[model samples]
Target: MTEVLETTSGSSPRTRMNKRILTLAATGIGAAGIAFVVAGAIVFGDFGIAPDFSARLAAPSWAHWFGTDQFGHDMFARTVHGLNVSLWVGLIAATLSAFIALGLSVFATTCGRWADMLVSFLVDATMGLPHLVLLILISFALGGGTHAVIVAVATTHWPRLTRVLRAEILQLRHADFIVVSRRLGKSWWYIGRHHFLPHLLPQLLVGLVLLFPHAILHEAGLTFIGFGLEPTKPAIGVLLADSMRYLTAGNWWLGLYPGLSLLLLVLCFDAIGNGLRLLQDPRQAHR
Candidate 1:
């Protein structure tokens, strides 16, 4: 029994150490991939729009890596530029959604029971509708621009994170510290600023990170369906939409490159979120 206990204790630390290292590595890789895309976007933004009609429909080569589309634009340049634009849109939408979640969570938890019920109903009603359909309708109503995509995604994505934060806030509401603060005559704002925000920070951060991939994918989907970003811009959806024409003509790179890049971007953002979540959880073994 003594030997077993010693071995178990020794191995536990080793396992946790291994987990920490792997989590950090995953986060680092995700950050590096994002940075590379951001840098590529800066370098290739002009190339994406500069049509070289002379090289139209050229196959992938040393001169035009990733090939030239029928419009004579470089696939590699457009892929990078589109991804960066998608990144910015996702970042803006996700940030707005996070703020919305935080605000609603606070209102539901701090307000009377009726307020909580009302917020819950709203969340459910919003969530019950098809997410894509809601996005399309909202975007169309706003006349379909980059701003419209941001607004649509921002509004649609909040309910989920709001639900998560609401649960957290509810639990926090009953905590001894919060109760004590109220007894001492602290205002709700004071208690929240001093107590609730600290505990909620981790969940908020993780939710925001996880929200990125969803926002990006939805924006791309909206654009692909003719209602997100403008077709003239170098959006991944625009690239993919244009690629469809050449895909059946034996030009596979047009579709393959942008789609694959978007997939990789989403995967990397997801990895970052998951890594942050695992690292923050003390019970790493269970995960």
Candidate 2:
């Protein structure tokens, strides 16, 4: 009877296989993403800034996988180094954005009604504006560098996460456990540190992970438009911008490989985030 029950349960063989596939897919993608970033770091440290003028505008070959740019720099090396820069910028910006969202959400939920209203108003106002326009304006105003790009992306990307977290915290604030803690003379800080923070961890992590791709893309966009890292910097946006001039001369490899690499990296992050979201759901356990 036990054997029969096991065979008939929701965790069937097919379901288990599917779950395994999903888990493997997620793990593989996440690992690949990390490995790509690590490879970029290694390449940046070892081969960065080693341009050869003799090989200028060379086509892709075994010796130069991604071909050579106008400066005769190895596109493979530059792309990898550029990837490292993009990853660093993305990570820092996403982390800052998440913290900003967390702080605003906490304040809105714990302070007072007026605080909540003010936060809501601010979030709405920020969201109402054109995101790219605001980012460009902020980056331009800040003098168009790495620090400026990071600040612009961080400040502009927090509103959506802030809204979600604020709603979650508002719901949790009136929970019976929270009320009990309040009645027991626990201060808001104490309750928040012990109760609210633990519950917010998953949401915070998800939001941070999801923000990575956006941050990377925006940083690249700003750089491409001459408002991000300087042209001397080996960044993805800079690479793309430089590739534009050679494209009309039929040197497509200059842009093709780097662009594809950026797209692949973004997709990997998206996959990792989606996988995490799915894993967090209990209903997915049997599937």
lDDT of 2 by residue, 160-279 (tens): 999888888888989999999999999887887899888998889889989999999999999998999988889999999998998999999999998998998888888777777666
Question: lDDT (CA) for every model shown?
Answer: 0.90, 0.88
Clashing pairs in 1: none
User: CA shift at 16, candidate 2, in angstroms?
Assistant: 6.5
C-alpha positional error of residue 130 in candidate 1 after TM-score superposition, expressed in Å: 0.6
List runs of model 2 lying over 4 Å from the truth. 1-13, 16-20, 43-48
- In order of appearance, the predictions have TM-scores of 0.93, 0.91
> Residues 106-207, candidate 1, lDDT per residue (tens digit)?
888877788789889999999999999999999999999999999999999999899998898888889998899999999887877788888889899999
Q: What C-alpha RMSD separates each model from the true structure?
A: 2.2, 3.1
